[model samples]
Target: MTNKQLQVLKQQHALLAQFIIRLSLFYQGYSKAIDEELQTLRGHLGSNANFTLAHVSINKLNALLQEDGGVLRRFKTDTLQSVEGAAKALLATSGKANANTSIIDTISQARRPAESLYDVTQLCVQTITLYSQVTDTLPKPVGVAVKSHSNEPLQAPATLLMALQEELVQLLDTYQKRLPDNTELTILKQKVVEGLNNDELLNVCLTLLRLIVKDSMQEAIISGKVIQSLHHSLSSLHQGLNKSIDQAHCTFAVQQDDNLAMRKELIKLENDVARSDSFSALKTQTQQQLKQVGSALEKREENDRLAQQALSGQLEALKAQVAELESKTRYYRNRLAKQVATSQTDPLTKLPNRQAYNEHLRKLLDNRNINEQSLCLAVVDIDHFKSINDRFGHSAGDKTLQVIGKQLSKALDDNDFIARWGGEEFVLILPGLNAKSLKQKLERLRTRLTELPFKFKQDRLTITASFGGTCFSHGEDPDAVFERADSLLYQAKRAGRNCVVTDKDDV
Candidate 1:
């Protein structure tokens, strides 16, 4: 499906999942409340087992509900488990109570409606607890994925990929512009874009997607820590808001009570003045009381205003701190991304280094075997690579290697992949092909390389590579196969440089 269709499906699935979870929670809460209420009723009957069972079950359920996440289908099953556990706990808790049947019978004769009402109150608390659990576990199963079955991997269309690539370039340029001193993340992003520039992975989109996910995962841990800091900051802000609200409520309640008492006092004073004709004394006393009340109200208002101002300042400070922590976290995360790039990348060729080659080989071999398909491995070594470095300097040698790397990458078919095996040596993985065809393909690549020359200082330098081809067998050890290819490579070198060698040449 297209992105929009996929998004729509995900939204629908999430809605359904949410609805189902809500229904399950409602039923679970209702059942638990019933069990707790029954436990209370049974308590009067002198049976302790039933109430204890319900208590344990409700407690267990509450624990699970308090947890961060749970699988959707596992929810109803968990609810049932809690119910059964409660039943079992009740039976176990009441075993001793059942033994004293005579005492139980005496209590059962005197159960009251008030006790029942108290039981109902306990049930209400349990129901509230269930609601809390629902809120906590809410937005549960956040992802609802839709999978498709197609022989070919689903890929972003070429136009979309090109647009995305351009957008990414613009975004990175923007980031570089904003954070000029931050070289680590900027370098990594450039390298990532460089890797995606190849037509092979971009055409399929899966490899690019995986690379993106890998990069995201690398930073996600740091991002998660930053998020935790924000969470704590938000919690503090929430506490401040709650405190301010409580203060306002307390202030209002106190003023209300004081005003009511003041009204009573004024009424009594009015009656006394009417009976005794001491209107001046009554007025004086009433004014004094009113003045005192007004003073207290003013003081309370001033204190409240000051407290609110302080809380607001503190909340703002907390937000700013969170922002600073996030920026710092990104710095560390960028450093980490740079470290990964250096370790996995070949600095000289700007390609996947030896470790990457090994990893890719293993994955490709495993995949080929699983599919029972043929695979081809070619070991390419440049002819007299050291002589070029010695004669023209390492700069010339480096330029040649770079040109070769680009040519190798571009010359290969979409299904083919190339990796920098080691210094001056490259490994190619060609799936769904055998040794005979690999030789021909490498010969063509060799001819193509000889035709294209690179400028080195004042000289136009031509490069040639020797190919050692081998067919991959399923379930064979990767090292052993690589050793075989290496041995063939030596044979090609010995026979003559710039030539292809395979098992047929062994004779």
Candidate 2:
């Protein structure tokens, strides 16, 4: 190796060391033993140790990362979830007189510890920023958000319960097609229509997801069976074709032999006539030769007839096989189409899902006329949704989402689009709307939600959402526009939820 090569290698080693140090810092709280191993590996890398010796430590570190990468990823996800939950809890308590300061301080101090982990730093920063925003908006000192427990019947949110009832009924209808005699699911479906509590709603949601998965798997299995049957039929056809070819060859060979025999007899008869001493001898020889020729001709015809019949039978069988395969192929195609539709829809709201939104956005961005069109994107978040879940239950919260989603969707124009953006949020894609018009449209939708007559366990409730909207600039990235819209939405939240904020100068 050259001197320059050795220097380059050392630089690469240094880079690797820096990366390992970052990982060690990021994954600090996973395990003490793992931490010790990381420290030892750092020492080996930091020192001017032999290259091969350092490689041993490098290999060990690599093994640890590969083996526990999933665990680390899950830890990061859990932490992010915690941060988000805490932020939401704090936001829900903002402006309330009973909100506790000690809990707020604990949450603040707990998250203040430097989390140098990869993307966690951003999440932590966002949480603190949310805290600041909440504090800035408070009219008084914050206090506890939770209310004391009450002994009231926990009726599931009305809309959510109805949706579940409909889903259950639909499920039972589907089940009946397969087994009409089974009444268990039918009974359950009827029971759902009567009423359910939060726990029951949770179970129903879980069961719905499970049944959906099972149905998907069932479709896959049917597709597999169709494919397998098609394959078997094709294999049979191939073998039949091979047999037909062999039979045709054999029939050709036999015909050839019979023609040769007839020719020899004719030649022999001619020679015998030429060498005959009398007409009587010639006539007898001619008779024998003619008879032999007739027999050979009849034998050839019989062999040809049987070979044709066999080939015709094989052809018919192959035709049937091909037809069966085509039918199965059509069945599989339909199943696949259904699966695609299912994948792009959200089960809860019956709206297009995030995957669908992404696809739609991609197509729009790829269009030539996209820049010429006036496109507006807005994010809507239900205000203090977590509190609804805490007080009424998740079922009520879900119903609230459903009702709001339908209201917003109903309020949109023909050119507008809406999708559930996961967890009490919905995104709208409104084309041909400027900032002013978009703001008006969002306000209308917000007002409509407030009018919804929501009741949980005889407690009439008012629901509201915050809106953040932005108009697309010429050739702007969708993500950037979405982030801007999201920021505006948070601004609406800080402005005391249930209002619209847009990136318009006049507004």
Candidate 3:
């Protein structure tokens, strides 16, 4: 390949990396919104059952409409109207209720489709735009002879661009077709179409760095803004989700309180009836009154049971939502790692950039809890990293790090996590492990590293890594534990580098 073609390929690779990062971030937001929505739907379903019981009381009140010349008709009508109004109120507050029931069937069903669409769209857009930018930046023809001899075709860039556009168009069309026919869907589709045709299109065009030479950077210039627009659209979804959940919670609480109040009132009414003494020849009337009250109590008890069942179902649904959210979060994390590696990671070694390591450490500290089980942290640093880098250049340095990361990861159990801590440095987290076991594991890992020979450019390079480990031991704070491990790592470095060190006090 000519220098120009190589340059174009590099530019394309960079764009692709950026696209992936943006797509992953967007999907993360979408997933979170869906989770929140699912939780809200569950809450709404619980509230609906509670309100249904209230409607039953209203139905009983409506029965009085048949009383002749009793002025009951108006009261009954008013009660029915109140029930209708309440149903409408419930529907209005729960966004999921507004969706076509046939399409989603349940709140849980509705959430998945919408969330999946969002993620798919984000990913597709990122992929295509990156591809387009890369193609557009192909080095100028140099000379016709050079271009022809280099096996570069004249129409490849245009063909690739058209293919990308077609892909995006198809994705959007498929998404729209899947949405249930509704005003919301219509509005969403219109917004998406407008974004694609206007600012988003312009941004895609500008991203082609070659367009800069033609004074047409409009697409690249607006790409960031288009991304922001997409972000705003997603943000609106979360707001709607939050409102639904809030309303559901409020309705449930109110229904519970009302049920208790009704029970108390029924008891008071029964006591009043029992204490009365004005029924000389009205024994039958008193008996009838007692039967009616008993029936009402029984109905109330049944309603309470139904309401409780609904609430329990809602809680289970919320748990499912939380689980879904966790899964989505995992996906986002993996996507982020891929994106970061493409851009900032040592391509050969596939190790975390310095920035990523710092972020990882912060996350570890933030997520740690006092009551959590024992946590073992190990820091491993290569013994002679600089010598390898000097002898074989940066490429060999990368391969060494990648091999080390792979070995370390393979040596640890599934519960353990290993990440590139920094240049030639690695960190591992082993949960539910005590200090002694952690030490033994580290020693074994060290031994394995000593035994292995890393191959690069037809030469075998032997390497050793020093390990320092400390355990949280049930009650210790994360910061203190990390500090101890770090100090031990320094100790290992001092004690001839290829060894494992633990806190002396613990030993």
Candidate 4:
């Protein structure tokens, strides 16, 4: 080919390499960002049943993301190789006689890598959808601020915290606030010191309590040990991988030196052939020398090509090894994340715990457009729940709680939010509802609960509840709204239990 055309091909090759490098960088950066977000999300998601659902979803998305990263890397490597191969093949041509076929063949050969790049990009886009599903599967759990999470263990300000605890106990005493019996009170105090510092922490602690009793915590603990072993396994595999790459580089360097020597020998032979006299004056020995040199040159080229193929095979094997290690790493990581998700759900009822309920309530109130969007909050308590627990058994009480939770969920609209708000109390967040409608809905739910022949171990019974609800007013604290509803619930109890009471009540 002409000097101008070869120069143009080299320029194109360089430009292609630069573009491929940039694209690879972009994919890697974007992937890293997605991974970081998922990790942060996992932290916020905490632990629970809903989190289990979310964890599985997160892993699926993460696997897709990891696959996309691998594909993008492969596509970049193949594209650069294709561009280099096409440039070299074109530059090696003796003349322009077969330029069109050469160009067409090169383009045809490169098309697969281009298509691969497109497919990988498409797969990356699908990851965005998987990510959205992950968000939907659980949503950010209530009250737990993952933003405050730290690798460092929390060191509660001991002296100050103690004084604060004493002050709180005294304050409760001054108000004549009722508390559990001394044995239960001691347990509660220990829980406080062991750091149920706030309502949210108590919710998380209680949620985990159910899991521990049911031995899910034992399984998670075993899983934790397995994670450690897997971590070691990944580290060992990574070490082996680095060794393989280093050894391959050593072999490649030696091959490169040998190839350089062969090139020098071929160049010297070409110069000797060129210096030969005119055809009529050419000697027989000279012709023999030229023939031998040409054969030797062809053999050297073949050797160089074989070396490259060997090196390529080694590099591909290394890539596969790295990918496998990463897959295992992600697997272990996701399993651990599942445990974290486990902590965020109520163990017995498998509902979002109180912390999650609080967040849901806050979100409803915060997202409300005061003029257009009305919201309602309700607190439902099973009437005489203690009497049932005392008469039947704690197991029966648990069964009752579980049954009521499920019944409440099934009875509510798909858009309505419900959660176990500690004990036999259920909290509801209903958006786009006025006080009248909200009361009606709660009454319907209460009626459904009444009809439920709650069965535990072949013993069937019916139970009822009292509900107090209020409309969410703009510029009001969500806590105040709930307090008002709770007060109305107390009023309902005074009027006689198993009733729905709302602000509309003239009482």
Candidate 1 segments whose C-alpha is farther than 4 A from its true place: 1-291, 358-377, 390-395, 413-417, 429-441, 454-462, 469-481, 501-507
Per-candidate count of clashing residue pairs (backbone under 3 Å): 3, 7, 6, 12
Instruction: Give me the displacement of residue 121 in model 1, in angstroms.
Output: 72
- Sorted on lDDT, highest at the top, how do the candidates line up? 2, 4, 1, 3
lDDT scores in order: 0.59, 0.70, 0.54, 0.61
Writing each residue's lDDT as its tens digit, candidate 2 over 1-507 gives 999999999888788877877877776776665677777766776656455755787687665555455455434543543454454456445664434443343344333333446557666675666555555445432693422364754343344344444445434444444445756555555566556766775676466445544544455456556657878878887887888789889988988898899899889988998999989988998899899999988988998899899889888887887787788779878877776676677766778866678788777767626458778899999998867876887568768878888888888888788998666779999888888899888889988899989999999989989999998888887767876887798799889999999987323
Instruction: Put down candidate 1 lDDT per residue, 1-507, tens digits, no spaces.
Output: 899999998777556545534545454443444445434433432322343554565565554433312222222322222222222222222324433342222222212112332343443344334333333332324484324454554443333333344334433433344346866546645554554543543442343334433444444545556657767766765776676677668767766776676677667656656765566877787777677667766766776687678668767765776676577668767876776666556655777765567677778767776678888788898998767866786567667878899889999998887887644788888887776787788889889888885665687777788888888676876655666786788788888778889866762
- Could you tell me how far off, in angstroms, the CA of residue 2 lies in candidate 3 after the best superposition? 82
Clash count, candidate 3: 6
TM-score of each: 0.41, 0.53, 0.34, 0.48
lDDT of 3 at 251: 59
Q: Of the candidates shown, which would achieve the greatest TM-score relative to the real structure?
A: 2
Point out the worst 10-residue segment of candidate 4 by lDDT: 170-179
Cα lDDT, model 2, residue 386: 63
- Model 3 lDDT tens row, 1-507: 999999998777556545534544453442343334333333333423333443454343333222221222222332232222222222222234223232122212211222333443443343344333443455546554444346544343333333333333322333234334534434543443333543444454343222222222232234335445546645654665665576568657766765676676567656756876766534655566567667766776776687667656666655666665566557656865654554334333455443454456456545665335556788898997767866776457656777888888788897676766444677787877776888789999999998887877788867999999987654555456655776798789878788999874332
The per-residue C-alpha lDDT of model 4 at residue 139 equals 32
